[model samples]
Target: MTSPAPTLLRPDGSNLRVLVVDDEQMLTDLLSMALRMEGWDVKTAGSGFEALQTAREFAPDAMVLDIMMPDLDGMAVLQRLRQSGDDVPVLFLTAKDAVTDRVAGLTAGGDDYVTKPFSLEEVVARLRGLMRRAGTAHAAGAEPILRVADLSLNEDSHEVERAGTEIELTATEFELLRYLMRNQRRVVSKAQILDRVWNYDFGGRSSVVELYISYLRKKIDAGHEPLIHTVRGVGYMIKAPQ
Candidate 1:
C-alpha cells in the first residue's frame, strides 16, 4: 500500500487558481484535496476535452496535466494550447519514469513533470517552483541596453541587435529576452525569471516563458544560428554567438 500523500501549504497567502487533469478520478480527487489544503482554488477534469474547456472557463493560474490521459494526451493538449498562444504554466504527470519521457514532455512545451506514484508534496513543490519562476520573469525591471554576447537589447528603444543588425520585440517579448540577456550564460531557471521579471511568487505560470522564448526564436534565431540552449532538466541559457 502507498503511504499517505503529504499535505502542502499555499506559499502566497491567497487562494491560487489551479486545474488538475487526470482520467483517474481517485487520483484527481487526491491531488485536488492536497491543493485545497494549501488554500488553492482547485478544479479537476477527467479528460483532455474537459481539461481544455475547464481551462478556458477557470482561467487557472497553473495546470497539472496527466500525460497518459485517454482520448487526448497531455503533450497533445499542451501543443494545442501553445499553438493557440495560451501561456498558462503546466506540470505534467506521467506513469513512465524514463528520461525519454521527461525530455519529450519538456520538448513538447511542458514546464515540468511528476512521475506517477509521486508524493503529493513533490507535485506541489514542483508547481510552486514553476509558478515562482513565471512570476520572476515578469517582474524584471526596465533597464536600458541589456547586453549579452554580441547581442544587445536597448530597453529604452525596444531594439535588439546582433552584430549591428536591428531586431524588434514586443513589450513582453522584449522583457523576456532582456532578462535572459541580463543573466547571459547563467543557467537561469524559469523560476528565477518569473521572480525577477513577474514579481509574484509561487502563483504565476511558466508557459508564458516558453511562448516568449518561441517569439525570441522567430526574431532572434529563426534566420540566424541558434544561440539559446535548453539545458536538459535545468533551464534556459543565452550564450554568445559561436
Candidate 2:
C-alpha cells in the first residue's frame, strides 16, 4: 500500500501558524494560499513593520520573508526579531541570487532562502523542511487524523468520515469543518469562521457563515444525533452527544 500523507503541525498538536512577509501583495497572497492549503494558519504582512507587529501577535512557527522592501527590508526585520529574542524560523524570498546575498541572509539568521519566480510547490516543501528543522513544527506521521466522537477528519488527505462512512466536502466546507474540529467543544464565533474559512477579504459579512453552517449541518448532522451546536447570540461548536 502507498504510505499515507504526512501533516506538519505545531508541537501542541495544532495547526502551524506561518507569517508571509512581502512588499508585494500578489506575492503574499500566493504564498498565503499555498501555506493555508497545507492546513497552516497564515498571516500576511505588506511591510517589515507590519510583519514584526503580526509576529508579536501571531507568534508564528515560521516566516516567509522578502529581502527587498522599500520600508524595512527582511534583513533588518530579522535583526529586529533576533534582538527581541523571537528566534522564529525565517525563509527569505528574494530576487537576489548573489552568493554574498545568500550568505548574508543566512548569517542574519534566516533559516532558508528561495529565489524569485519560484515554484509554489517548492516553497511549500522548503517551508516544511525549515519548520521541521527549527523544531517548532513536525510531521504528524503517515496518517494524520483528527477525531471527535464518530466523526473523523484527515488533515493529510482532506478526507472526512462520520460513523465510518465517507463524507464529501467542498474546499470551503472542508476548511470550516477543520476549524470547528480543531477546536472541538469550544465555541467559535461567526467572525472567526468567516476569517478562517474564507479568504480574509470577506468584508466582515457573516451571512455566508450561516449559509455554510447550514450546508455542514445537512451533511455532518443529518440523520444523526447532532454534533454541531449553536449558541444563541454567540457562535457554534462541535462535540460528542453525551
Candidate 3:
C-alpha cells in the first residue's frame, strides 16, 4: 500500500511536542529526525536526569522513553514524573527484549512499548496513537469528526465516545476503530483493514485484524448494542443496532 503524506497534529495552533529519551546519541538523532518529519516538535534527552529536566521544560504531549539508562532507568524517571504530577503519555523503548521488561514498563504506568531494532514507522505510529488517545494532539487534513450511530470519533482531538460515555483506547485500537468508523456500515475486508491501519501489507497479516476487531467489540459492543459485526467470510462492519 502506498503511504499517505504525513499529517501534522498541532494542538492549539502549535505543533505537538514529543520528547525522545535514550542514552545513545545515534538512536536519538535518528528517532528525532523521523518525528520531525511528521511535523511534530521534537526534543531528545541522553539520560534519565536529562529526561526529567526536559520533560519539565518541554512539557511534551507524549514521550518515547527508553527502559534502560546508566544512572536512572526509565522506570524511575516515570515514577518521579508521576510523583511530580505529570501524566504525560509514555511509550517505552526497551532494549532488553524480554517480557519482564515489557511488563515492567506497563506495570510502572507506561502507556505503550516497542522493542529495540523497531521500525521508525512503528515508533511514529505508536506516538501518534498515544497523543491521539491523550487528546494532546489532532489530525489536520481530514474532517475532524466521524460518526456512526451513537459512536463518534474526533480525528483532531482523538476522542471516541459511544452514547454519552467517553472511551479510552490504545493507539492501535484507536486507529483500527477509526478506520471502521470512517467506513461506517460498509464492509471492510481484512486485507483492506491491514493496509489502512498499519500502512503496510505486513505480510498479509489478517489475524491481527481479527484480534483488534475483537478488542474493539469488547469495548465498543459489550455493554451496548453491538456496533461491530463480523460478516463471516466477508470481514467486518460497524452498524447501528436498529
Query: Which candidate's lDDT is highest?
Result: 3
What's the CA error at residue 32 for candidate 3, in Å? 1.3
185 Cα displacement, candidate 1 (Å): 22
Candidate 2 structure quality by residue, lDDT tens digits, 1-242 = 97633788876789999999998898889888988999999999999999999999999999999999889999999999999999898889999987788889988888777888899987887787666545566567534588889999876567799999999987568778877997999999998886555423245678899999999999999999999999989999999989
Comparison by TM-score, 1 against 3, better one: 3
Estimate the overall C-alpha local distance difference test score of candidate 2. Answer: 0.85
Model 1 alpha-carbon drift over 4 Å, by segment: 1-14, 136-242
In angstroms, the error of model 1 at 135 is 1.1
User: Candidate 3 residues 1-242, lDDT tens each?
Assistant: 98784575766768889999999999999999999988889999999999999999999999999988998899999999999999999999977777777778889988887888999988888787667666677667667888888999887767789997999888789889988887888999999887667554446668899898989998888888889999999989988878
Cα lDDT tens digits for candidate 1, 154-176: 64445689778988666556667
> Using Cα atoms with residue i matched to residue i, what is each candidate's TM-score against the true structure?
0.54, 0.57, 0.76
Cα lDDT for residue 101, candidate 2: 87
| Candidate ordering by lDDT (highest first) | 3, 2, 1
